[model samples]
Target chain A: MIEPIVGRYVTIEVQGVTQRIYFEEAGQGRPILCLHTAGADTRQWRHLMNDSEVTKANRLIAFDMPWHSKSLPPEGFQTQEYLLTTETYIETVLGMVTALGLDRPVLAGCSMGGRIALQLAALHPDKFNGFIAIEASDFQPAWYDIDWFDRPDAHGGEMGAALVSANISPFAPEAERWNTLWMFMQSGPGVFRGDLSFYTRDDSLIARLGQIDTAKTPVHLIVGAYDLTCTPEDAKRTADAIPGATLSVMAEVGHFPMSEHPDGFRPFFIEALGKMPEPAA
Target chain B: MRSTLQTMQARLNASDHLKHLGRLFSETVLIEVDGDEFYLTFEKGAMVSLDAGPSRKTPSRFALRTDADALQKFWQSRPAPGFHDIFGLVKIGRGRIDGDMLLLVKNMRFFKEFMALGRVKAGADQ
Candidate 1:
């Protein structure tokens, strides 16, 4: 049987560079722009796209960040090192929204994506109707040395997969766990480290949390119980900082909630979506 | 601990994947469980020696130290969160690593698989 998800590409200008970004979407109605984690592709949203509960009334769209998966790096990428900064990341997401002509879509992101979602809430609250930040926080210190992820002596693929494997809960089905690892194994060389540049190096957004007008754009968070990197406490801290924000600490799951346990992640997402103000007709 | 280490060594050596993963790695690793020490020396991925004692003679490149209770929890087939992974143990203050962190991170995949052998043995024993 053919899958409901449809994949395509779009040409957009981001940070003064022309990029052909790859994206996948399923279903229709109010748009929900999904963002993937560091070094991961849009495939992380596959299960959500296929779920009837999510698709019946909402459109699910996910895009791979440049230098990740099918979203190839722009011209002259080889001339210098690839490092993700908040400015460039914000430009990319805004570029996608403009290129696709999404009308105030709800922004949903995980990890690095989740951080950006919060940033958007502060920087451009009216851009979307709501936000869903999964396994994200305002400030997170680097747990592992980024250099080890892309050294010549180590197999970057295996090392990346092994290090991040702990982010997934042991309770997840074996197949789902391995499937999630497969994406990390397939990640481009140095890409994981490059993505961590934004994740580990970014300044704390805690001071800026007060700027988020949640009354205009509601903020929702769902973190995993077993995630040591972005612990439930981290999500709570972010949630508590924002008035009218909702938070849920999921049990028996870890960092990659959507990929590692889609069945478990669905209810939280559905409830969050339900709470969001409906888009104008 | 001695018998379990023996079983783990045997299991690791028998796996071709582990052999390939560790082919370029060679180091002497110290494992300390509640002050009880066991030294495992590897040459090109094959475990050449497994010694049990508190010897100041053979120096180790790195060491993994955890209490017996934590080690037991980590070895379970369905280990609880914070015990399910080596890094998780470190994050939760249940385990500690000392010396040459780069060496351990360089061969992280191999080291993780090496430690996971205990899980296999534990499952079999059950």
Candidate 2:
């Protein structure tokens, strides 16, 4: 019988803000930050953290992003008044890394987290040993055009409510439904809408990606063949833009491939991490 | 009476697989509408209400309901050519369709047969 892998919460100070970051740390060797998708916390990477490959080769640090589960948003932060910019998110992540004294950790993110990973790599290439993004894409034009700040209660609007309800299904166990619903509700409407706006805004990181000094570090992109949220075409385009970036399309998977199809993705993830180029002398 | 009439009407609505429609009455069929929080069971041609809790019993056949408008369109074009083309538009989430997905590829006749029965529709295809 296999024992279940459990995670714990730790509080780390970012700048002046003391935020709680939930993480699952295991194994030894090179450090790697496993970032989760939007509306999801570190739990999404539970399978990866416990996988034999990760446990043997790298030290996995899975954490909840700010304004997400177990992590508190900065004080006086107004979701309706302030837009959640990708730059702000990257800065916070950098703060956490610096505060913890982590050595050039390899960065990995899924979906929205993936977008942040790309931004971090481009903005602060010196801080990371390598980067990996799953189902990440450039922001669509429609995202920035919408003004979610104008409506304070827009988070609880019909579409938001419907999405919330759909996420928790009757097929899931009662406990699972309760936990998932609680996270969605606690994340609140403004934060949710703000994040969506941040994601949809047209910020083409594609052109900026090639400028990253990948000669010293490696970059990888993993996508699902059936990812409805971000298609393989988008992943191909991103790969084409980034110099020497490798793209792997997993079979029979979707947006949350880490959870939906871990078995098929573990080997590829391990292979990519193993191939990370040695730091420039 | 009106509610019962509606239920009967919904059940009576002819599926392309009326020939094997009898199978629906004999075997248990689970219809999971992924988008909606609705999972229905049809046994002996009648709907059965199960407790809203987790159970060990899995369904024999699963049908995903994509949307109401697409369902209406398919219903209107009954006996229309190229019914299997509907699967192209329909999106399937994380559920198994009972019949052989390969047969649909290898033999177009079997494909048409499965689509004609309208036993299962992908959530996106509805």
Candidate 3:
């Protein structure tokens, strides 16, 4: 039985939709907003929440994306067209920041969360102190080509069910399966479709990588040697494109390396966080 | 391949506890597979195999199998949810645990810490 940590739930208005947001705070320093992957909620960071490194130095904030976990899906939420888009995600993040009174929190994201973090950094550079992207890539949009809005549901076809299942963790506990399923349903068919849509699209940050002012803030690219979803090669390319972007790869790890090898991942993450510049003197 | 295995055996034999454990067990094997390479070191006490695969090898009592790609994901995202809640969804390939599930669970923390140190060492060398 996982109990909710010390946190509060509030509503944020984004594009005329009232979205429910849950957040927890720990320690006291520059704020670091930890974003979760696409199919997961803020619960992903539960382990880090208790880490001495996280609790002793930095203020940590983690939340579910719109329509995830405790967050309610907005009316007419469409995944293919709207759920994972840069604009919608950025707006929700901005709204949450405004609601919480956080000033320029450093953003850290994993997989889908990483993509959102990059988009936020690129689109709204004023809102973040720095950005950390874990196993993320600018190549997602090129992986698939399907109209997510028109895609079928779990009951519709095998491909649809498989696609939907792919987003959720295959190693998820048995007890949470039904609850996760319910969350998926509430997220509607559009959410996964939107993810596929976003993943397969070609709008990338590779070309603009050099434009990012890494000297003013730290940008760290951490990857696992065996991540099939976002290959280390992709990470290497992205790192090479960005000026002074440090890349670290852990051996004997995979797509979800943090969970697969938590013992190894923490030190590099801590070192990266330590390198973050203090907020403008 | 056999020479690599011999080298690994020499390395393990050099460890006092492992050498002692080797005398107790009838048969054991220590295999490390990374990419296209495979190395096997057979011992007696406890059979352990660690697979960082782009290659395949025989299974053993305790196996920690992952690849470079997955390692990156794990590093970038620590403390991921769904393991406790969604284990079935994860694919645990190239891994085998032949005995003492309870013992494995008990020593999981130590094993994890050891592996963590191994990763750091590997990173530093690179």
Candidate 2 clash pair list = A143-A200, B17-B117, B66-B123, B90-B124, B90-B125, B91-B124
Q: Per-residue alpha-carbon lDDT of model 1 for A1-281, expressed as tens digits?
A: 89999999999998789999999999899999999999788988999999987898999999999999999988988876888999989999999999899999999999999999999999988789899999989988797788777877776767888888888886777898888988888988889998998999987577888898888999999899888789998899999999889998888899998899888888888988987878998
TM-score of chain A of each: 0.98, 0.79, 0.79
Q: Cα lDDT for residue A36, model 3?
A: 70
Candidates arranged by DockQ, highest first? 1, 2, 3
In model 1, residue pairs whose N, Cα or C atoms come closer than 3 Å (at least 3 residues apart or on different chains), thus clashing, are none
Per-model RMSD to reference: 1.8, 13.1, 13.0
TM-scores of all models? 0.96, 0.62, 0.59
Q: Any idea what lDDT model 1 has? A: 0.88
Worst 10 residues of 3 chain A by lDDT: A153-162
DockQ per model, Cα:
0.72, 0.04, 0.02
Query: Would you give the TM-score of chain B in model 2?
Result: 0.36
DockQ of 3: 0.02
**Which stretch of 10 consecutive residues in model 2 chain A shows the poorest summed lDDT?**
A162-171
DockQ of 1: 0.72
Candidate 2 wrong stretches, greater than 4 Å: A1-18, A77-82, A142-186, A202-204, A277-281, B1-126
Best by DockQ: 1
**Poorest lDDT segment (10 consecutive residues) of candidate 3 chain B:** B80-89
